[model samples]
Target chain A: MNHPPTTATLLALLATLACNVDRKQDDVPATDPPTPHVALLTSGPVSDAGWHAGAYEGLQLIGDSLGFEVSHQQTRTPAEFDEAFISYAEDGYGLIFGHGFEYQDAASRAGEQYPDVTFVVSGGSRPSANVVPLLFHLNEASYLAGMAAGAVTAAGIVGMVGGVEIPTAKGTFVAFEAGVKAVRADAAVLETFTGDWYDPSAAKEAAAAQLRQGADVLIHNLDAASFGFFQAVREAREGGSEAWAFGMNRDQNDVAPDVIVGSAVINIPAMFLRTATAWRDGTLGGVAEYAGLRVGAVEFVPNPAQEGVIPPEALARIDEARQAIIAGELEVPRIEYLEPEDDDPPSP
Target chain B: MNRTLTPVLTATAALAATLAVAAALLALGGHSPGAVFAALLRGAFGTWDRFFSFTLVRATPLLLTGLAVALAFKARVWNIGAEGQLHAGALAGVAVAILLPVHSPLLVLPATLAAAAAAGALWAAVPAAMKTRMGVGEVITTLLMNFVAVFLAQFLVQGPLQEPRGVFNQTDEIPLAARLPALLPDTRLHLGFLLGIVIAVALWLYLTRTPGGFRLRAVGASPRAAEVSGRFRAGPVVWLAFLTSGAIAGLAGWIQVAGVTHRMYEGLSPGWGYTAIAVALLARLNPLAVVVTAIVFGALSAGGGAMQREAGVPEVWVRGIEALVILAVLTVDRSWQVLAGGGSRD
Candidate 1:
């Protein structure tokens, strides 16, 4: 009855509002070639204070140190990947960092469209002429941290609590187990995956289960869930049991300094800065850029408060192993996920 | 005439009030409100290219799901399982498109879409059967089904449906022949938008013209009244609404993958089904108006990104503004109804 007129009015009102709100086109002033602009896109919020936060810090570092105009967008869905990439490229962003493996496909498509703009994806697989994968070899550091865990464990049992059993997370645990065996051949090792990267309760429960099974030292490869993992170890100490934990992904030594023996950290901000600097100098190749102990982008940082938690001999062995890994003499166990480079085949 | 004029004036007042509040919030957050709004408008509709590529592309899923929700709500059927149905549709579509071994574009596309629709209908059948046969409430069943569907999708993608390489937690890209054809050249807008528009028009016609539509509406108004006066069983009409709504929603899922992503992933939907409730409500359960309301929400989404990019507003702020606008609109609509002596419908 009256609904027809009401609907008509609604449409007319929307039309008028849209027409009135047309953005003024006179804002842009003709300017000669502007400074190179850089942008970052993350599927999750940067306020997570771990993986995404590290990337955000890296973007800021590039802006502060390299003097490039930097911007960041927290994209919600896969659909937004292409939209964000195109929008930034259209707005004259010279370099854009899509900070996840999920971005590789979208980055590849956007790369083909905007060949002039370089798109970098952290933990990405595929790489094209304009798409670069920034691979973080944090397993190298995790191995050293595992050596420390092996030495510090009073029960001769160490555990690894990981978030998601993806190749990247699994690689860290594999290398850690290897490092533990290298230190204590008879040591018992345990591993558990929470199947999530952000569920704190799940991570805590996993860590608690490992501790209850006589594991004195634990290392975790989780993001936001690391807090819960550390809480389990801290709670063990409160229960009058000797427990120590290791942090992963970023330098989290201060997060739970008392219970944490050390941390396997990927210097994400530094790696981002180096990549942006290379892009600016036109030296950034389409090939995947591996950041590891050799490049000083990954390291095992000992907690200052937990001094001498790792025995002297064990610390020395960790240092030796770190050197060997950097020299390519020691190969830390890692899951090879990246597609083989097409341009340069591996020598048989 | 007075009835229509009052509601329209109330809606206009609501729009002005919401904008004023949004401006104040933006200014409080240390952003220039005019600049932020300008950036949002520019990002959503400044260019023909953006309108087609971003706005319409985003609207395609919303439009389909909105129609599904509108139709169900019109019949007073609480089909809260569109999210699950959409996922079931996507999973079925992808499974058929990838494994069917049919390379012909015509055959593969149609078969894939039909499978999706069937899967969605099947998913809704569970809740429908629970409600009709067991006399169970659909609200809880449909809502719970969403979690089950999401976890099932995650399991399939991580296990059986994983890419050949088994590195990423997603399915392999569907064949090129299965991908939706672009509706507009040089834009991300696909045939899905056209499909959605056609569906909306068809649904509008059905609701306004058909005898079956009248029965459904009569039952929706009051099942007892329909049974007494129209002498038609409300049960069959309710079943029809649920199945049809589920089928449309299922199309939305496959259309998204067939059109845009080209593959099924864990987070296939960003809660488009949940958002569809708001879309349907804002359109007053009218199928045709859902087309416009869906686009309005699409613009908000497209512009939300720009607000972050151009105005330096955080995603939280943008989301908050969106919620505020929706609340304002609904409040005004309700207040007008009450003032006109109609009271609340629900």
Candidate 2:
């Protein structure tokens, strides 16, 4: 019958909690060998299983291998970007990884302010003395996947379903087209962008439209929505047509073992570890870091379930092209518009 | 109890309850509740720069949208489409900035804002018409219209309104003329925040001073009573409230674009419209109190980043606190109503 007592108890608890916040506590240092602290900023949840997830895994790997204290935050808006960078830098984090191109400008601003802290932006275009872009050459692997698709398809037509028509996305499709034509000279290429990154229904509809246009093989540059592309191909196969799908970003071959031919993967965790180690060694930042087939960062992972689906001759060509790219004899087509450090003088 | 003091006491109680619950939850998750709160405070208001640049910057959109929702709810017009109307306003404002030849701030700013307001009113017209003419619930209609607005924005950014080079899935930045000047000399605090405060004051006066405002409140209190006793039709008042609410929400969108982001993109809003409901209800739908309530929510959002960086507290925990605040406020408000004889029958 006495509500006042409950309210009074709550107020007393809050007063104690407030006092506790002001009391100084012993610092429990979490690093050994006095390693610099590292952190990561992502725009989406790490459980996304694709872009954000890969970056999260990379942050964990860096922490484990380098013995650096690491933390991560999922930022929501551009307004939050600067605050996150400033917080990390001010808190003595020596290295911060922003896992998207969107972080380029904020990273640049933070890099200028915090000269001692290194900022690495994945899929970023701009570079600076303290800000580095981790150029993910997934397009190179996508081209190889295109070669595999060209060899596997019997109808001499291929399709690509993309989340958005950003330059980086279009670059993959462009390279994919060139690779397909390299294998099957007369093959037709159809491209559709769903304009959505996570909508399965829209991706499926776009994929189905491509299938109706005589494209028997489809590759999607979508992240979590690739399942819809695979589903469309599966439905087409159920309706008495032969259709296949290729995965991009992380290895998603097992997502639909029967329909997915292969995956174009960027070994994000390995790349993070290598970059963090390089930073510790004073060899990272001050320029863009390029990771491609040469560095074993990107690869066209063949699905064992789809073995023999792609002709061995096409696989041989893909392997030769991969080696050629590594040996500096072949160059993959890429869109390079995100240069945040372009204004700076070229570093040796 | 003094009537004017009741809402303040209720809000304070609700806030205390939320903090207690949040503290318990943080402790359960193996984090120091005190440390998390300290980090949040430092992040939101530790320094003057942090308070003005971070917390107030985040509060700008919330203030406008909160006032918009509070105004609409005052007349009992359930407008859940503020999100959609915001997008409509932003899209129209950005379109004018990109397509129009106006180059001076004097010319471009007003033109763009006008276009935004008109577009927002247009977006609300559909739902308002449905409610007025066809007797459809504005709740369902407004909510569904949000989907249309979101999709339209996505389509435009990806296709026609995409950056001139067609490289990114965003519109070109608004011209300098159309952009809002900074209210502070060296901070991100823009003129839009001042505009929001001015609008809130104006809305308070309009609601308290005008005969039209009295009629709107009467219609909201009892449509039959207003129509018979006040000798005025409730339908026109409802329509007026709905349109005005959409216009205010529209201004929020364009202000965000012109003030902060500088361009429209897919994730332009982090659900500020939806969050504004909690803000409005917490203020008890008072336009003047909405400013303070919006800042409280803004501090939470701005501090969430600091929690992750300084205390290693996850964003999910901050989100849990936000949800708990909304729940606690609703409960406290409901308890007051019950104590006031509304729930005595039960």
For each candidate, give its TM-score against the true structure: 0.94, 0.91
Please state the Cα-based DockQ of model 1 relative to the true two-chain complex: 0.34
lDDT of 1 by residue, A231-340 (tens): 99999999999999999998898999989988999999999999999999998867999999999889999998988888888899999998999899999999888875
Off by over 4 Å in 2: A1-9, A24-34, A112-116, A234-242, A339-348, B1-5, B100-103, B343-346
Model 2 per-residue lDDT at B262: 79
lDDT scores of the candidates, listed in order: 0.86, 0.84
Best by the lDDT measure: 1
Candidate 2 CAPRI assessment class: acceptable
Pick out the ten consecutive residues of candidate 1 chain A with the lowest summed lDDT. A339-348
lDDT of 2 by residue, A1-348 (tens): 224455566567667765666553334343232668899999977887998899899998987887788989999987688778877887788999998888876787788888989999988877888999998888899889888888888999999999977777888898888888878889999999887778899999999999999999999888778888889999999999888888888899888998888998889999999899999999997789988888989999999998988888888999999899889898888887764445542211
DockQ of each: 0.34, 0.44
lDDT of 2: 0.84
Tens-digit per-residue lDDT, B1-346, candidate 1: 3422443344455555566789888998898877777778877986898899999899889999999998998888998999999999999999999999889999999999999999988888889998889989999998898898899999999999999989878998898878899998889999999999999989988987999988888878888898888578888998999899999999999999999998899889999999999888877777777887788789888988888887778888888988887888798778667555785452
